[model samples]
Target chain A: MPNSETMAGTSAAHSEAMIGLYDVHKSFGPLEVLKGISFEVPRGGVVALIGPSGSGKSTILRCVNLLETPNAGTIKVGAQTLAFSKRHRLPGDRRLADFRARTGMVFQSFNLFPHKSVIENVMAGPLIVKRMARDEARAIAERLLARVGLAEKAEAAPARLSGGQRQRVAIARAMAMEPDVMLFDEPTSALDPELVAEVLAVIRGLADDNMTMLLATHEMAFARDVADRVVFMRDGVVVEDGPARQVIETPQHPATQAFLAHFHRR
Target chain B: MSGVSYHWDFSFLWGYRTVLLTGLAYTMAYTVGTILLGLVIGLVAGLMRMSRNPFIRGPAFAYIEIFRCTPLLVQIVWFYYAFPILIGIEMSATTAAVLVLSLYTGSFYAEIFRGGILSLELGQWDAARAVGMRQGQLMRHIILPQAVRRMMPPFINQSVIQLKNTSLVSTIAVTDLLYQGMLITAATYRPLEVYTLIAAIYFVVLFPLTALGQYVENRLRYAE
Candidate 1:
């Protein structure tokens, strides 16, 4: 048997999958949302999950962050791994929190805290969750807000900004945590057509910086442009997975072909 | 055809001003005290009602319902008489009055708070949790700030109502505004003048607060 030191060294060395989901299963009452789904996102890789509405695309992203607990699976992010079964008990609140702190999630509604000024919203997670010092967090927040092109709007309230600006602030807020992996669940789906471009630009910037990301999005063009790999899912299962060019362009599976055809027609 | 009248004397009010003002001070103390205590109770009870644990949620739900359903006067009088017997600790009439009144006001405030919290979109909760905020941090930093803003107008309105409810404490001999006014009326045999003055004082205090509540409600009416 390998010693504890060797095991730790092995996991540290070979943990290329920054985020992984193995046979994740989820159900709400009688309806199964995710059925034995599996995926792995390597370090600094960009994976876009594209699928129809009920295909459990968002559920997979949420499960990676443990927002939704799966009935059966093993989720690995960096060195932290959680194994789930029918009666799986969560390890501890502290461990789960530490796991979550290493992964950042962006939502569809761009949920910037309405009561906070834009800069404070960006600084909140680091200051509150990570317990960072105020000046350091504020400096990081200022730089991030600048990176997202909202430096001038730091003191403004969320109500004063456009939907795209709010989403960008949300991205900056998530980036403040400096996570090992980022999850985007329909980030641009709620924005106006013109506004979507601004938000997508910031996301593309993250990809340029080699941020490991998992995006569940409808923007096929943006997905193709930014993603290293693309996974096509339908009815709680992955229908196709390959290079972004082949999956979006060639689409060998009939389901993939149909899904892409619908997108093309639109 | 004769309206019962002794010629009304506005002159006596000047002499009685200190008495009336002293009573006003007591009323103010009671009002502020009840508001602080009531708000603390309402916040705890409101959060307890939201708890998933049956043990906590059930008691919180029952407390809100019981106090809200009973009359404030009855609750106060019951506490004044029964509390010493039940708890084996005699409380002053003023103490009993304040305790019962704060509790009564708290039930309504709890409902107001609960409604404010529920009114927020579930998305806010999700977004906060997604960012690695623990449940306590999320409620404190995200949910409560927004909910408290929404709870403000109603909370102020409840304060006004509780101020008026303090009039009930006169029955327990607390010598509040109403009680002092009653004493002056008996001493001078001028009921209309003294009672009218008392009514006007209540109006003076409460009208501004009600108006402030309206202003806050208007300001908070944002596109949620």
Candidate 2:
């Protein structure tokens, strides 16, 4: 029952797990993406899911937000719990929406609403979903824009921004919701090489603020530096899960070692 | 072939100016009314076409396909001539024309709406949902704002065709512009000048609309 106020100043040692997935299984037609995946992100924790492509890292992040429904297992975020199986049905849209509202997600593509100005995109969830007053929403949006270093670009359309700038706006948009947990599905993967650091810096700032996050990223060094824990997956199962430095630097599993080898090659 | 020219005189039709103007008014009225009604139908049917329920999707599919595949003239005639007989109510030619034309235009507009919505990348939906917006709110605020921009060119294209399709009302004995031209031709016996004037009037009205569509397309293109 940890709240954001209590969670904010705490470190990853906080006893409560903010997000929990137990034996989560998801399949897309014939291709099974998540096979009995289980994990937890403790309150004020930053856990990074690192693996090569098709290792279900993105799928795991998506499932936690209910973006991709799991075929079998339980997902608990905040106070809401959803169990999916043959006998158990996915929650109704309203409940699922309520569940998702507690968690914010940022996509690889930086899907900013193209028609809206930067501020409007950030304000949309509050203004439209929460039915917050316009002035209040604008205040929150402006603060978030400033936080992401995009305050001056607030009036510009999303189509007009650079890739890094757009991703920053996306992070701001997600933050405006003030969700208990944040999900980043390859946030920097779509950015230019020069732009990746700026986006990652914003994420690093969030980690410093003690925001609970589960990110699936290819940025190995950032994960090792910013994330409190790392879960290494390959072929839809966790191969290694431990402290960020140990899992990335020293590996007990040969599979994990071989995977890290590719990134280590000079 | 001999180069023979008949006398061109529009003086006789000057007396029928009021009638032609009234006819033009009817044409404009039907176009405006039907386009508005058609848009409502289009929005509803278009969303329904995307529904997951078979019951909802099936009927929308039938309505769009049945109207779109048939000729407008045939639909106008059937509604005026055949529909009333089946319904056991005597419908006025005006009522039948409006109803038939709106439904006809709606089918095309539905496809345009659907295509415009689908044309957006899947990331748009994903992003909106990530923000916790419901289906209706997402479509209204996020999806539609972007989709409407993509839909503008095709929407205008369909609406232009809708203005021309209003001409089909003449077959149902509605006094739209073309029907007035027939009356003028019958009275003045100058089919050549009368029909020419009618074609010129239609051209004058529709040319600007197509130009506006092109302008909008360009603006949207540059906007991206």
Model number with the top lDDT = 2
lDDT of 1 by residue, A182-239 (tens): 9999999999999999999999999999899999999999899899888888888777
lDDT value for model 2: 0.89
**lDDT of each candidate versus the true structure:** 0.88, 0.89
Instruction: Give the per-residue lDDT digits (tens) of candidate 2, residues B66-177.
Output: 9999998889888998999998999999899989989999998899899999999999999888889888888999888878889999999988899888988988789999
Candidate 1 collision pairs: none
